[model samples]
Target: MQAVNISGFRPITTSVPRSAPYPSSARWRLPMKSSSDYGSCDFSCRQPLRISSSFSAAAAYTSADGETTLIQSSVGISDLLIVGPGVLGRIIADLWKKDYPGSQVAGQTLTTDHHDDLRQLGIHPISSGSNVEKFPNVIFCAPPSRSADYIADIRSAAACWSGEGSFLFTSSSAIYDCGENRPCDEDSPAIPLGRSRRTDVLLNAEGAVLEAGGCVLRLAGLYKFDRGAHTYWLSKGSDENRPDHLVNLIHYEDAASLSVAILKKNLRSRIFMGCDNHPLSRQEIMDYVNKSRKFDKTFDKFTGTDGPLGKKLDNSKTREEIGWEPKYKSFPFFLGVNTD
Candidate 1:
């Protein structure tokens, strides 16, 4: 086997016996035989059939014919590369470290501005021009803001992925064209390309990931304690606020957990929705914020009644598939309101 350059990252080459007639791609679920199995039993590939070097210590069995079969014992989050380790990416990295101690977590940033901060959190930072290593588990959390061509960026990230692991792209739920406050799901129709520039870029990028057999997570509005839509609304004071327009939201922690779940599952070419399953209007959100008195500032009253309504996202199927439940169930719940 020879080293292959994918985008700018080069996969470390390991020689495999040419006499073995293995298929181009295959996956196997092998039983663990030792304590060093990384707590996972699944292994898969997408490129030319070859086991990952990480599995060098995998178990092997010899048949009567003297043929030896190597079984990959585990495929866990041992080595991870997070593209654009911003707020969400950093959270994911923290959780990864907590769950899998001693695992290496590297983050890629566009500049050296926050490299020190990443280092403080025990994350190795890869600057823009630095050589990227091919990671078995990769999660792309970079927004499309700075990219001249977001689709191309996604392609480059996809290329840097090792075929033996999972690659996930964090996309936005804004791609869905369900603006009339209609209920939306993973199967909802996306805003057609060319109609909206933002959606077009995201949709194209998502297409690139799916074509490469990666998973796509369309996340709803992400909010934390101090930063989010409510914070922005309170700061800027929108005069044209549409009080009736619904908005779907998810806490940052929940979103990070969902990302981790999807990566661990290693699903391919699948789209998953992430939301709190609680759709609240602008007025409703503000009402809860005011009632809680958690913030020093409060949002002004929203007077406007007519505008384009956001989608009501129902991720019941996603919850069932991923076996995840949000810690902060809704905005009101987070604000200590008994919505039940």
Candidate 2:
């Protein structure tokens, strides 16, 4: 990828290459965890970049020699649109609007259940039959369950988008087929699931976004505000299959803020693995959640199932590029927060 300049900031480019297909493997199970939870670009932000008030804003003062000085000017940008405004989408939309008041924010959803809610929040609802309009920023958070057609829709809209900033698509890290317990980055070999409709659809979606020169975020599991895979499992007494496998997670608020930061910064990294800095084994998480929540839910240990497929997702590059770090560092830490 080549480097380019945008608004005086250097942006790095990102690209994904085609790889030979691999045979299908057994579906990896969500290990029983205690219930832990958890950029570059020359683009202008929604508002002028402001330094901390504690710092003096003056560029410089004349010394013995009367020399004129200058302080760097901050940049700002335009509006945004979000496709598939689900839970995460809603949070993103709210945060985006909060950060960019008077910024035209549009939202597209498959249903109208939340139309009133979105309208109250000042997000303009977009219908499927509506004419395509481009904005300076765009985010696609559609699910793979919508099928490959969902991907096609994003590609079509992105192709016609008038924005020069960036397009970001949220994808799952399950694309990586790691069986051994090791960390995987954006360059790691992705898992190939032959004949699996869901896997095929998601992979195709990622390819479509990348091909469009847009950003593809491979996010780890998400948990926040009484919702999460671990919470569901604990409530259902789900079996603990992979006690040793590590689980990568990010808080809902953190994910939303991170995406906003990327767009505001107009970063160039095409592919990013989004996760918290810490990775915990299933057993450790389960114990922490069960103890913290006082649930004490028990899970059955496994023996013969090819030892559970596990992997660690690294998000250092993503953090470095975006210049944002997660507010919640680990699932346990998140749960321990005092709501009061």
Candidate 3:
């Protein structure tokens, strides 16, 4: 299997440009552990970009003059049309609507034959469920390995689409043919799967999207709502090494926000990473969860298979180019640190 967690070290901050990105400090707080548990972060978020008050409204793409104009010019929300209403898809759509209330955003999903939900959410679902004909920039979060066929369909009929926007097909880091101990990053080079249908299909689909002018996002396991994988595993048992395995989970907030950020950056024909910067083994996580457990339920140490076929992914590109940093940047808080 691929390496179990993201390794190597890089300071998580950027050099301040004399002028500020926000009017004051970019007041965003990292998840706080109990004074007894997590005293502070182990990694360095030190770039002197620290500010106060507004984390969500801060800009990483600003200039020396400290103006929002430059940031908008470099990166701004783009019109987005997402495919599939899987957990990931729904979260991305919700974030887009919340962040860019004025932008045109619609989702193409497998119809549930009901208009009430879509109507209430103000989302347009192309329930016709026919092949995707056209879109400004299409994002496919479909899980099946054969989902690539849909991208091929769109490519085959490229003439139908305006051909100026982008297409971001969500793929997993599992394409690397990994094991349990070794870890991998974006530039680590993917191990050829020969004919691994799911990984292979993603490759073909990526080629088609790039050929037609778009980008690919090789993502890590995504967590959100109450359905988070880390949260599920953490709430399990405390067998010491119970949470000892390295974890690479991406918060749904970051995944969805990154999709919007990529489009805003106007990138084409490239790939980027989307995993949390903090690396915590499964053992440590489960302990934290059990200690913080609320409802008083008996916990069991979970062990079956090693883990998913994939491991960690590099996330630097998403931050440098797209100005997209995860809301939940650490693991314990990435899942356990719910804003709610």
What do the candidate models score in CA lDDT, each in turn?
0.70, 0.60, 0.49
lDDT of 2 by residue, 173-202 (tens): 888777577877756767653544555666
Ranking by TM-score: 1, 2, 3
Instruction: Give the number of colliding residue pairs in candidate 3.
Output: 15
Candidate 3 displacement at residue 317 in angstroms: 3.3
Instruction: Give the Cα error of residue 211 in candidate 1, in Å.
Output: 0.7
Question: Total backbone clashes of model 1?
Answer: 0
Per-residue CA lDDT of model 1 for 65-97, tens digit only, reads 333333333333367778899999999999988
Off by over 4 Å in 2: 1-77, 193-196, 294-307, 337-340
RMSD of each: 13.2, 14.7, 17.7
Judging by lDDT, tell me the better candidate of 1 and 2.
1
Looking at model 2, the pairs that clash are: 33-286, 34-285, 34-286, 37-331, 39-321, 39-322, 177-191
Please provide, for model 3 over 151-222, each residue's C-alpha lDDT reduced to its tens digit, 9 standing for 90 to 100. Answer: 433343222223345566676766554456366665555544244555555555544444444566777777
Error of 2 at 66 (Å): 67
